[model samples]
Target: MSLRRRILILVAVVCVLAGVAGLSFLRAADRAEQRGRTQAGGPEIARGGLSLTPGEDGPRIVFRNMAWGPNRDELASVPAAAPEGARTASGVSCLRFHSAGGTGICLQAVKGGVQDGYRAVVLDARLREVSAHRLAGIPTRARVSPGGLRVAWTVFVGGDSYAGTNFSTRTSVLDLGTGRLDASLEDFTILKDGKEFRNADVNFWGVTFVADERTFYATMATGGRTHLVRGNLAARSVTVLRENVECPSLSPDGKRLVFKKRVEGLPAEAPWRLHALDLTSGTETPLAEERSVDDQVVWRDDRTVVYSLPGDFGADLYAVPADGSGAPARLMASALAPAFLG
Candidate 1:
């Protein structure tokens, strides 16, 4: 072959080889992104849908796929219970039952040998995993709307403690019906004293939604003070209802709110007491179980409240009367989060 012809042919071969290699690299990268790993080292993708029809059996307390009857000792594993054929991802930090039918779970998986962000997993009434979304911060709280059309969560990014300095939180809401996700409540406009309010140090967490999906309640902390505020999801705005409320859980009847109030004359290590506020009468009554409760209270029903407290073994669930009567009674021996399985 002529020298010039030989040089041209060699150059063409090199270019072709380079192009093929580049395409292969791009395809590999795309596959890795799709097959993300769960904290339990399983594929993060959802499986097929499963039947969510409740058994003829009565109501059950569901934690993950495990169901416990009235007798805590009679526990049965129902790993196949997820509706829509979805399974609970491993490394779930929190789980809440959706009133409409389904479950919302927050997974805190580890990536690159460090605590990665959280994943909000949605399961249908049949207990099938339906959708999953990546979220920012450490999962601190997770809640589903009364109708199961909405999911809300709170994550703590940086801070040693709730009352510690230099910590922040992100509260987000997702509309399953609309497939719209609000990653942060900080974007919502705040109305304090009937005027627009904005501040750099504002932080929000502990979101509780009412029966009406458009209206909700959350904790907003700013200027070293925590206030309970009622929010309108449609308007994207909040109106301060009261102050000194950390985490508020709305009553099923929508007539009262149960929350933790910082009690005076107590050591800073544990200074909160559970209290119920009557929304109409504006009366705050402390519950009879006086041990420092540092958890967002859950209303098991109109008259009973459930919460978690730390113990030597782990966090245990307890129940108390909402009307400031009866002592704290232990329900679950070592359950961190408790929600009624609807």
Candidate 2:
């Protein structure tokens, strides 16, 4: 063929490919829009005046709503007794959230003109933003102290998934009363195996504060194993408690910890089994949940623990006995990161 004819043919092919790409993009956008509308048979969600404080309605469960609708991804609440009922969605949205004593730690995404960013926000009793700190990367776990005086959050700074072998996390703690912020828990002194430990690859995540507000527990990953560490904010130090524990959630009585243990023979993507560890006896009892869970669980009560698993919409919450006796039961659909407020 002539050179001019060949050039014309190439131009025609490029235009055809561009047209197809544009059409596909439009279709995808339309499908996303449809997700904003309520689907039949899905849980009802409505905008309302949601408060973190316990009131006449009694105890309520606040979580990140994952149901497909206008209020999807927003912080929502439902009566703890009727978790499957209609949900009241607050205007604020968070990727991960936890609350205690009328205070909330919300890790959220911020859209920018060029790139998206993440931040940790503190919410008051009225679910209003008290303060916000810009994060370095994607938010993962968030927690607020029992007295509503402190907050902590974790973000992925390097690798993506915690299930993988290589990843980095940045955990931060903030004092709401004093306006003091610990940007990274790595700055604190670490004691492992009865000696001061220091490593360049150490990463910390999944912080759960104790009732005393000075003590906290978190997952510290260094070398190849994960350890449950007890942290002291006043002392600016952490002591390694045990190994193979990730995302430890302390019981109300402070005598036990509910954490995800990596069980042998399971796939790396789903390697964790919920386990309860007795702090006094060092006994670990695997919970009744057969499926793998990759979440930082919350204590619904002294006896029951709640965690999230993958669902059709996004994620769903489930509750299981902490003593490894009863079977796991579905608590609510399309919910993640639950915090029981009373």
C-alpha TM-scores of all predictions? 0.74, 0.88
lDDT of 1 by residue, 33-56 (tens): 344222333213322322333334
Best by TM-score: 2
State the lDDT of candidate 2 residue by residue for 1-342, as single tens digits: 999999999999999999999999989756744443346568777778888887588999999999877788999989999999888888799998888888988889998778888888898889888998999988888888888899999899898898987889999999998999999999999999899999999999999888899999999999989999999999999999889999999998999999999999999899999999998998999999999999999999999999999899989899999999989999998999889988
Global lDDT of each candidate: 0.69, 0.90
Question: What are the runs in model 1 whose C-alpha is more than 4 Å off?
Answer: 1-55, 64-100, 110-115
The model with the greatest lDDT is 2
> What C-alpha lDDT, on a 0 to 100 scale, does residue 266 get in candidate 2?
99
The CA-based lDDT of model 1 is what? 0.69
Model 2, C-alpha of 181: deviation from truth (Å)? 0.6
Prediction RMSDs, each to the true structure: 13.0, 7.3
Clashes of each: 15, 0
